[model samples]
Target: MADSLRESAVGQLLRLVNRQWLPYPDERPEFQLPDYDTPIDQEKPADHISSIGPDHQPKRRSEGEEQDVEAFQLAKTATAERTVSRTLTPIRTSDGIVLVDWYTLDDPENPHNWSSPKKLLVSFEICMYSFAVYFGSSVYTSSIDGIIERSGVGVVTASLGFALYVLAYGIGPMLWSPLSEIPSIGRNSIYIATFSIYVLLCIPEALVDNFAGLMVLRFLLGFFGSPCLATGAATFQDMYAMIKMPYLLAFWAGAVTLGPALAPVVAGFSVVAKSWHWFAWEMLWLSGPIWLLMLFLLPETSAPNILLRRARRLRYLTSKAQLKSQSEIDQAHMSAREVAFDALIKPWQINALDPAVLFSTVYTALVYGIFNSFFESFPLVYPIIYDFNLGESNSVFLSVIVALMIAMPTYCFYYYYWVEPKVAKHGFGPPEQRLIPALFACFLVPVGLFIFAWTTRSSVHWIVSIIGVLLDIPQFAASLFAANDFARSSVACGCILFAHPMFVSIGVPGGISLLGGLTILCAGGLYILYFFGANLRARSKFAAK
Candidate 1:
């Protein structure tokens, strides 16, 4: 009887151990490992919870030998369900697929998945805004005489206003570009806010009685109107896939070039018909419609921003504690100072230290400086030598527009048919390949500058000098566009800043001749890049990618 009592006690102990240490049959299925070879159609509950949840909290374990299996299983199941409830409520298809991206595959919130018509509309508005803002920057050049007379500033001092405006805008992007990338303040918001401020500032700029006030207002206008220069290309990247970007970017380039080309014509007539203030009013009128279009039409295109908004909405609706966007989650540990340093300081460092960036910047800067200098020199050449009025002098810039119209389409055909096909069949060619067209075009810049410099005399037909400008502008535009494609944002902006000072120092024919000589040196640099860019990129840590 004592032995039988002992056996019963042992059996009870064994049963108790099994119940505590091992889960029940129902719970086994929940914790079972998935098939390793097969694809997971449905995201497991645990996997979904872990991805979106806050960091797992530490729990204290009991030191006692015995534990409650039923309680543990119940707790785990509740935790998983709560996680599911709080995080992204993924759509599960009848075929067991889980869709957990920021939006449904066809969701309109994703810019990439936007309808073709919507994409076109947004692109058109962005291009138009870019055109208008750039036009505003250059229109003042046409009113230099008015500015000189009204402000009582010398011609050089009045020209300084334009130079400072360009410089300020170039630097402005260094700050605004980084800010626009933030989720809370996206591309659309930045564009809308700055462009509005830009439009308002134009009024003060127009009405300013002194050169100092005009200069200040001009600087502020450029500072506020910088988004189109800094972030416009990024917008295209955000909206379109790589396949469509070439054509879209080409179109954008054409629009941007058209701005400066058209500005002289429009402001020339406006200033002659009215006062210099009318030029500012013209800009205000043009910008007002652009501002409205952007406010209504431009959708937020940043992927991180969209995902962040979705995450916030889910958290609000579900009241889940740990739900976060991938960007938010990744950035959770980064300090504000670190973020600022990376965004603000790092770009300058890259521009300063990276050879590839330096070369590209130098090339583009040379082209830009020469192009802007034409504004000052064209009137000197055309009016005196050809006996033209301000309107006729301004009309000369039409050759640039014509050249752009011809060059853009031709380059697009070459890129789409020849260059892109090679890239497709083989791997990506070296960065040097981007400079091939630029190599040939760089030679034309010096040729055009020399031709225009020597031929701008009464003896030559007016067409000869215009032809010279025509050759240079198209070649410069084409080369700059190509180099820009390979350059970093900071590098491009820095180069633009460099151009402002170079163009401001006016010496007429002497300056033109100097620029022509400089073009020859720049052409040599282009050849070096064409031959050695690949090797340089391979060695550099921060080479263009």
Candidate 2:
């Protein structure tokens, strides 16, 4: 009885950690075969082995892949037209390996097959997770004055705590994102573990008095909190249909936008009500519960990880040494040289060699850097010119979130009415079709900045400048995959490091107008890409043909 109790406790703990909703594949009666041994002789494992190249991994089929074209087409016709691609039949591969796959089209174990309510639950959880981390990034900005006064540091030195935090998270995904891709480690483990560390680090950050200690702790906080920022959309893609993705992603992107937008309001009031230490504590208050909720409910979402665990269970049950998932097979054959190149070199190569990638990276980095600059710029404008208190001054940031609310729904409407039908009829649209939204947004940014630049006087109504801030939210495809997360983020970090100093040197009017002019140039770049991007992609080796 005591042993059973102990075992029950251990099983519960495992369930909480893994949070995979279905039974282990080995434990299911359908998976157990009375005639399992009879089929063993008929399996031609060598044929499967010879088909795969040494360096080839089982990648998610791209739109360019022949086999996936029909699937993509079928996905658009109707809900009734959708069909499952993989089945329960064990595929024997090279070296006596049994490959594990979904039981059927409706297999609940497959994340894609999960019910709508369940998918929404997971989506909401991840969105909250993303919001908490991004909220941490700017919460410190409201407390910068407190830090400067207490530590006797200059404005720039105090702001480094915020700037370095941004840089650290950008650097972090280079390491953490790769670990999440490993089938055995998976997304949930990376998210929960790192977020736990992030939440705990907030305690130290809140308590630390020294400038150097505070800087280090802030950087650590951002580093540990980064996985969600980089991978949250990838999680959305794992379950949602491609046709349905823009709608869901619009919401996810809104969450990202609102995080920093809302941060100042909370931290601003908290700092004024109590001490600056409350800014750090507020992160814990926001994030600690989020971590607990994630621990209990956030299931492992990576399809590779789910199948890999299933393969392990099947191997143990059948007493077979070679039962594996495709991910496991790929992992086994991957060489150290390939790993290093994929992790370190490939993103830079694509960014450098592909014009489309370079354009998107530069455009998005400028947008983010300017957005980050607002954290510094807002206090300068509102408190000095408008005579608003810290909390009220910080509240101007609500305009960004207001803009986000408007922009997301607007994008969804455009995708549904404009983009979706064309894609449905044509199989998939050209890459330039994705840039249509950007064409509008790129032009809007310069207009918004110019309005903001000219309207900084007390004689001007604050709402006009706030309206300009509202319109400054630019839409672009951000780096979503684990492979390129670091590349995009690093560039954004560099821009962020430069943004504050540029604003300080030129003053807000000069600085804002300069950014406005830059966006006008970027707007011209967008127009060029819209017309010429296809030709650029055709010439590039990295781009899809």
Candidate 3:
């Protein structure tokens, strides 16, 4: 094939026909033209054939003449005369270069062949950094009451400490995601730098004497730390191969589910043993060393960064002289600036304008709102009822921890291994698989809510009340995972997925906190209602009814 392509007269003519616009395919194999404007190489255009001469000179004036002319044309321009001008070769793009893969896989630079240690390293780092961001968001659960008393801020204003952090969670990822697209600012660096800023921001909350200062610092910390939570999944998607993606996502999803569970435990110590100010101080102290360790241990997990390094190193090892620098590589297909802009705007815009995006965002956010609200309500619910001591206030969260350990794995098995495959087999988009987790959540959330709520009493044995609380965990975790899958699959860039927790954290409490007077009864009823609504929606989608 190579000799025929190289030596054929037709091949030489084809090369001559394209001129310098198409480079020699065997060596400098690039088309020096825009992607859309590049000449179609797959076939000869009818007009082109005519212009080039005999290939498609058409027929004659009459039937006999037409047949004779066709035969002559076919004879004159046989495949033997023509040769494929451009040789098949692969090139890299800035996107692919940084990611250590060819934008086109046949390039041999694909990351799929990366060592197992490297892939595992990237996955672990994503999990921990994601965990760190969640920690910043909810770690203050124990300190809210104390901060209010010491700072003299009203409950509504102080809640902003956490609210603003979560708000950043929504807002931060939007910008940071684009920022990470830059080959220079690796995702690992982004995690380290922003998380470091987060810890410092917390210091003021611990040390500051004024409410204004606390709010300002809290917001600042969140503003800086926002990317960790916001960009986690995208980071995950970029690293793991497709086959491992679901299970990897499941593991990270577990961290996300578990982050809140462990938060109360951290806060419990702060509230039970120390001043709220000191608690802040302690968290600040703790975050610094942890971040330092993360910085030292977590390598750059961003695909682009990995590729950029590999491309640079490979350039040195081989004689492939035209190894274009990262920016120079993909600029033909998309400039860094253009790529970043699209990455930033497309997700939010699609969610607002596209029904699938909006529906997924709305459903997941609503369900997630229910789950996260449970996290936000610790101070109010725990302190008042059960007359629980400081640490005991955080005990309510234990139910969640226990339940998630059970529920998350079960949902994992059902989604990645079962429902998802069924969806694929049936021609449903990945979002369709999300609907199944909804079934699990719908069944579990209400049952736990009613059990926990009605079971609550000074005399009914706190463990029984705790059981209801415990059951709520898996239900929420399962629902949350489902909602996330839907949001990610439906939204462009999975950007709306970024809002899942933000919307949930605020929405759940915004409604549920109002009904703490009937906490168990109301919560149970609400979970059941949402789950029921979710199931109906899922069935409707499946049945297309």
Identify the leading candidate in terms of TM-score: 2
Candidate RMSDs in order: 17.1, 5.0, 14.4
Task: Give the number of colliding residue pairs in candidate 2.
Answer: 0
Query: What's the lDDT of the predicted structure labeled candidate 1?
Result: 0.66
Q: Which ten residues in a row have the lowest lDDT in candidate 3?
A: 46-55
Instruction: Return the TM-score for each candidate structure.
Output: 0.78, 0.87, 0.66
By TM-score, the better pick of 2 and 3 is 2
Per-residue error at 146 for model 1, in Å? 1.7
Q: Which model is ahead, 1 or 3, in terms of lDDT?
A: 1
Task: Estimate, for each residue in 1-545, the C-alpha lDDT of model 1 and write its tens digit.
Answer: 22111112232244357633332221243433222223443334332311332232211323320133223323332342211112223433333322223322234456665556666877897889888877877788888898878767666676766676667667777778889888767787788789889988877877877878787888788788878877887888887755457788778877777787788888888789888877788889889988866655566678777667656655554455444565665566678998999878777666676777667776776666656665557766777778888888899989877788777888899888888777656745676877787777777788888888778778879898788788787665543342232242233334333443443455455667887898899889889888887676676666543
Looking at model 3, residue 208 earns an lDDT score of 86
Show pairs that collide, candidate 2. Answer: none
Highest lDDT: give the candidate number: 2
What lDDT would each prediction earn against the true structure?
Answer: 0.66, 0.72, 0.53
Poorest stretch of ten by lDDT in candidate 1? 1-10
Model 2 agreement with the true structure over 398-492: per-residue lDDT tens digits: 87767776787788888888888887788566878887777777777788888998998889999999888877863422322223555456655
Give the per-residue lDDT digits (tens) of candidate 3, residues 123-229.
77667666666666667657777877877766556666666665555666666777787775667667767887787777667778777777677667767866755
On the 0 to 100 scale, the lDDT of residue 307 in model 2 is 80
